[model samples]
Target: MDSRTMIASLPCLALVIVTLGYLGLCVVSPFGRCRACHATGRTRSRLGRIRRDCRHCAGTGLRLRVGRHVINHLHDEYEAAKR
Candidate 1:
């Protein structure tokens, strides 16, 4: 294929891959980066000498992905009922 065709298709190819990855994450981990700390779970001072916990996930390095919270909520309710 020519360079022009390759360049034109690059975006579509990327979109497909991104969509597949997102779907896989939704089906699997159901976790997303902690926006508070940008997924680092902690941040360093400007001097890089000090770091702190992510307050959100409490430095767990992971957070529940969007739309999955309700699923967890429902599961919790079901478990409570079972017990």
Candidate 2:
């Protein structure tokens, strides 16, 4: 209503917007991992046998679907603009 009220609410507003955006992206996209280690981007075969990259994430911890990538790009742009 007033400037002070709006200023105090800015953080909450941003949080709500980000949360909704993330939820919408989650609904449209899905996550998958071929191995538990893939979720962490690397694999330790028996702790010391052999360490290797993840096939599921292709060495990245998080796997993004097609649309999810766009969402991520948008988020990055938003963050860049905010700064």
Q: Please give, for residues 1-83, the per-residue lDDT of candidate 2 as tens digits.
A: 99999999999999999978876866665564545574778887667789888776778777766556667788999999999
Residues 1-83, model 1: lDDT tens digits? 99999999999999999977876677688888888888888977679899988778889878887647766787899999999
Candidate 2, run of 10 with poorest lDDT? 29-38
- lDDT values of the candidates? 0.83, 0.75
Candidate 2 Cα errors over 4 Å, as ranges: 32-42, 50-83
**TM-scores of the candidates in the order shown:** 0.49, 0.46
Which RMSD values do the candidates have, in order? Answer: 8.1, 11.1
| Cα lDDT over the full model 2 | 0.75
